[model samples]
Target: MTKKIVVLGVSGSGKSLIGKNIAEKLGYRFFDGDDFHSTANVEKMSQGIPLTDDDRKDWLAALNKLLIDNPTAVIACSGLKPEYRAMLRQGLDDVAMVYLKGSIDTIWERHQKRDDHYFKGRGMLESQFATLIEPTEEEAFVIDIAQDADAVLNQALSLLSES
Candidate 1:
């Protein structure tokens, strides 16, 4: 079966990095969910404005299409809420989610160092965490992000193998 893997977490949690690595290791295509965002949504986030569910509907739909287009792919996305995840899983039968779990402080530190991303500063990170509805262990392979990137990737690979 084709495996569609979503690397999910709050901003600065290493979703893009780890997801890309996972895709390389698995020989699958990699996609950043941020690239699926509409121009309006990007503009709002660029201005440090948090997006409402309505603002996210189109972006989520686009991500879902990406999944459909690349069945065996690794996608980096902030699948922060259950409903958001459900939207991504609309028609997929073999989807696996890897939640890059991390403490707020750790993620905040990383966020502070990032200069190129639109997800700006501690406030945006706080908003992301606030909106997050963490997935249960049964629902995802949760890998802690405190470790080095390679270590975290290894853990994710190990968990995916088991599943």
Candidate 2:
């Protein structure tokens, strides 16, 4: 079955790059979850501020709409909370989430080197990690962020194939 894979992680975890590669290899469409975030939300993050759950309500709803629209597109998102993931899963049975596990230090280093994004400099890392509800045993497959892009994508693809 062609399923929509939602890659979940905090910033600098390589969700976009790895997600696109996984989609390409799996013959699915790739949708960056950031694309679904509202401009004001992005602006808030750009200024090194954390967004409230109220801020994310529409964003999660948008993810649900995305799944409803595309049906089988692979998406990358910082689904940091169980409620957020539940929101995205509304009415979508075929959606599978891949939690990219990694350390804050590692991600902070990557964030320092990262360019062209509003989220950076360890500003939102604590909030994200604090909010993250790692997929339970019955929830989703958890893939560690390995060496590079391809390694991560390979692990995700393998998990998706198994699922």
Writing each residue's lDDT as its tens digit, candidate 1 over 47-161 gives 9999999999988888888888885888999999999999998888788999999999999888888888887667878899999999999888988898999999999999998
- The pairs that clash in candidate 2 are none
Clashes of 1: 0
The clash numbers for all candidates, in the given order, read 0, 0
State which candidate has the highest TM-score. Answer: 1
Off by over 4 Å in 2: none
Residue-by-residue lDDT tens digits, candidate 2, 21-90: 8888778888898888899999999888898999999998988888889846888888888898899889
Model 1 pairs in collision: none
lDDT (C-alpha) at residue 107 in model 1: 90
Displacement of the residue 62 alpha carbon in candidate 2, Å: 0.7
TM-score of 1: 0.96
Q: Give the per-residue Cα lDDT of candidate 2 at 45.
A: 91
